[model samples]
Target: MYERVEEMIQGYIWKDLGVKVIEAVDGEVTLHMPVKTRQTQFHGNVHGGVLATLADMSMAAAVNTLVEEKEFTVTAEIKVNYLRPAAGDFLEAKGKVIKRGRTLSHCQAEVFDDSGKQVCFVVATFYMFKKE
Candidate 1:
């Protein structure tokens, strides 16, 4: 189930965000995204928006794996904390569910640089809507 969800996200939405899932479990999702020239800011560091997008995507994917098939989730709120400058080979984002409710879910994501150092952290709440 996790692999299926991962593939669905990779084959669908993640290319737009430049992300891919490396691992997924019951409560967690691990993703990787490259920090290329186009992704850098004026100061030459990876842009904060890119980091936030990766974090949000990771959390959404994690929530998707746990929710019912007939339900879809959308981001209700997201807060990102840029802990340090990000530059180098790639970025890693790991997301896990912190809480889950009938109509909403809360998840957290952390991004790391290629050297395995933390770069950013995010907490997101999602609204789960039933499919019609």
Candidate 2:
């Protein structure tokens, strides 16, 4: 499943955000996103939007592992807890599928800084649908 999804994972955001797949298998995925100065807010910390994007994307990637051909997942909603100001050269997000249903999946992710400190946590619900 991971091998099949890997072929389709390099979409626009994956390329533009500089997201690297550290591990993606068995309904779990770990991703690395290089932090850029442009991603910082006025206070010089990683912007909340960037953190949210990473969190959402990581969850999506986790959900992707469980889908079949012509099937995909879209985030219906997400809750993000910014634990600390993200300050580092890069960030790592570990996403895991908490529960999977026929039409929805609940997942959670933790984003860590370079020092291995968790900077953010996110729980999300994604809607699964098949393309006609």
Candidate 3:
């Protein structure tokens, strides 16, 4: 399942963002991405959108682990708190499922810079659906 998810990441928006799945098990996932110039703002800090993307992707990946092969999930809503400036060569996002329901999943994620300082925290809800 981890290999399949890794392969799917290569074809999604994650490919453009350079996100790589480092670990995936049960209802948890860990991902990392290098801090490239293109992902930063003019002030040289990682952009909020990029951090949010990392959080979202990680949470979605966690949700995926709990669903069937034919099932998929979508981000229904996400709330993020930017705690500090993300300035580093790389960042890691860790996500875990808080609850899994018949149609919805509650998840949380945290993003940290290479220094191990947390840069952002996120809580999200995902809706599960079957492939058409």
Q: Of the candidates shown, which would achieve the greatest lDDT relative to the real structure?
A: 3
lDDT per residue (tens digit) for residues 1-132 in model 1? 564475567554477656877988876889898888988999999999989988988898888888766777889999999999999989999999999889989999999999999999899999988887
User: What lDDT does model 2 reach?
Assistant: 0.88
Error of 2 at 45 (Å): 0.8
Q: Candidate 3 has which clashing residue pairs, if any?
A: none
Scanning candidate 2 in windows of ten residues, the lowest lDDT window is 1-10
Candidate 2, 36-124: lDDT as tens digits: 99999999989998988898888888888888878878899999999999988999999999998889999999999888999999999
What Cα-based lDDT does every candidate model obtain? Answer: 0.87, 0.88, 0.91
- Ordered by lDDT, highest first, the candidates read 3, 2, 1
Error of 2 at 35 (Å): 0.8
Q: Which residue window of length 10 is worst by lDDT in model 1?
A: 3-12
lDDT of 3 at 103: 89
- Number of backbone clashes in candidate 2: 0
Model 3 ranges with Cα > 4 A deviation: none
